[model samples]
Target: MNREAIDILVHSAWKLLEAKDYLGARELYTQGLKLDPFDATLWNYRSNAHMKLQHPELAFTDAARGLQLLDDKLATTNLSPEDRNFSVFMKIDLLFRCLLAAENLDICQTALKYIDRLLTNSHLLSNEARQTILSKQKSLKLKIKTKRHAFARASDSLRLNLNDVLNLGTMRITKYPWNEFEPFNSENDIETELKEINIMLEPIAPKLLVVRM
Candidate 1:
């Protein structure tokens, strides 16, 4: 309701944040936001405090709010270049916060989206910042690939093998009953005729191997 009081609250909040009083800073930011819910600065400050307190979900939400507010402000026509750049930097900062929160939450996909967004605004970034983001992008891609491979391996390892089910303690299974295989056209037909189809075959090394000692 009071602009002056809200400004005071924001200023005091920054001071507390600087003094490493994250709890106090968070409280002041929340009070200021209550008076002016759309204040981007308040949201940004509060997001930082949430991150300091290890609340990544809350931090991501607040940072996203700050970014949305800045985007609306930047869309207004006839803005001075100085004002535009100021808003641009603030947007970048909020985006970085979102990326950090996503990473802390182990949501690599969300972090990758934020990284791509930062890269889309590459013209606004300093050379050092651009380089850092590029490095992070590569690292994130590799991490995602690694996770995918591990999941694939785990799925194969955990799948139920019909051969194992048919194994008697005194005997070995030479073949699995393909008669029970799923996705078949008919339950009564034991054999299906092969259809002639055009296809390409590529030669590649096998992925997994076992050697008897």
Candidate 2:
């Protein structure tokens, strides 16, 4: 296909994507890719469509390929500051989504590095975008920390007493509400009651394992 035809297909893909017709977008992207396999923009759009379709692994693969192609193109050409900043942000955003879906902490950390670079170099990003990046970075850091803490706690529990660990796990698996509490009238009240119970019982619940140990 000619460049003009490729452009038309790309534009059609964008229109379909804007309309939230991801499958239609993907079809257009596939046609574009057939004509221009190394078109980074088409690949990126295809990745977005795949993500919307809940195909995270395929999305990540296409995003990575697009970024690689873009990087090569950038190395040879001098892009304007605004264009460079936008491209970097898009790459980082794609990586962040892919990492989150994969639960890959290392990839998330690498994406944060790009976010920091964008924040340092670009003044064009809106305050909301900056805040959102900061929020995502903070959330990923907390998730990694929480996983590490849970692993450490489990290890310590097992080392301290095997029977206690087993009983604790069993209790967690078996415990169920017996309907002693009234039906929650509102979401807020339900959340408040659950939070209170969690806070109050968390420390005392471990003691139950002592008897089993």
Candidate 3:
């Protein structure tokens, strides 16, 4: 397709997206992408369409490509500060979403790198937007740390439980002193013994308070 045709497709796609017809917009974006594979703006638009269509993976890939193209253009020192700042902001925002969608530690790390660069020019961003980004960064960091700590605690609990079971087995073996004794004898006998033991230990267990609704 020619430039005019690509422009027409992009315009129609934007209209469809505004109308919340994601499938139609996606089709138009796909067509436009076919005609202009290297157009960064078209890729960004396509990514928005994909996101509205609940295709996170495709959206992330397109966003990354758009950011790459933008980065290439902004690499020259001739660009105005405003233009460079805008490009950097867009890259940071896109990288943040891509990191969230991908849920990879490396992606999150990369996103933070861009975010830090953006924050260095925080004066350029609106107060609300800057605060929002800072909040998100704080929340993500907290979540990662919380998950790591919880996983460590769970691992410790599992190890303790395993050790307790092993110690119990050893005690039982010492009490029987022979494999031929058949300590359990049957499932019903084992259940009965367990019930008795639980009853004996019931008083020591933590009590639950009843609450009236």
Candidate 4:
């Protein structure tokens, strides 16, 4: 297609995006790519449209392609001011979304690694954008840390002391209201059990109350 036709397609697609008609935007972007298959800007817009549609895997694919095309263009000569800015923000945002869409820990970590690399390139991203990306990184890191810590704690708890745990081999876990007031059990027996538990927990309860205060 000629330059004018390509421009028209790109402009129309952009307007569709502005209206939040992601499916429409993607349709136009796909048509535009047919005319100028190597247009990184078109790919970037398409990627964003897919992202807004909650098609993260497709979004990541298009974003990666756009980045590759941008890198090739940069290798030959510098990007125009508008293109440069878009490239910078697109890289950061795409990585952020990709990280969020990742289902597994390994994929999340991989996406985060790329995000950190982008954050380090001070020349590409403005200070405000860098800070925004950094905040996202911090949140993802904390989530990962919490998940790992919980897993580790669970693993640790599994190594119980059989001596302290009565009838460790015969024990069966029960849901709360452990066993309904059994008709076979006397009120006195239930009261005695409750009293013993309260006595055992009495010292800890006072410490907990003080901490809460």
lDDT of 3 by residue, 1-213 (tens): 378999999889889988999999988877876776656677677777777777765666666666667777777889899987777767766655554444332344444554676677677778897887798678667775675577667778566554333223111111110111123223466555654554455466522111111
Q: 154-177 in candidate 1: lDDT tens per residue? A: 668678553443222211111111
Best candidate per TM-score, number? 1
TM-score of 3: 0.61
User: What's the true lDDT of residue 209 in model 4?
Assistant: 11
Is candidate 3 or 4 superior in lDDT? 3
Residue-level lDDT for 149 in candidate 1 = 68
For candidate 4, the per-residue lDDT at 38 reads 67
- Whole-model Cα lDDT per candidate? 0.71, 0.61, 0.61, 0.60
Residue-level lDDT of model 2, residues 48-122, one tens digit each, is: 788889876556566666666666666765889887766766665554454443433244444555466556744
Model 2's alpha-carbon lDDT is 0.61
Residue 149 accuracy (lDDT) in model 2:
71
lDDT per residue for candidate 4 within 97-197, as digits (tens), equals 54544422235455566667776775676788678767867777887677566756666769855334433322121111111121212256655565456
Higher-TM-score candidate of 1 and 3 = 1
- Clash pairs, candidate 1, are none
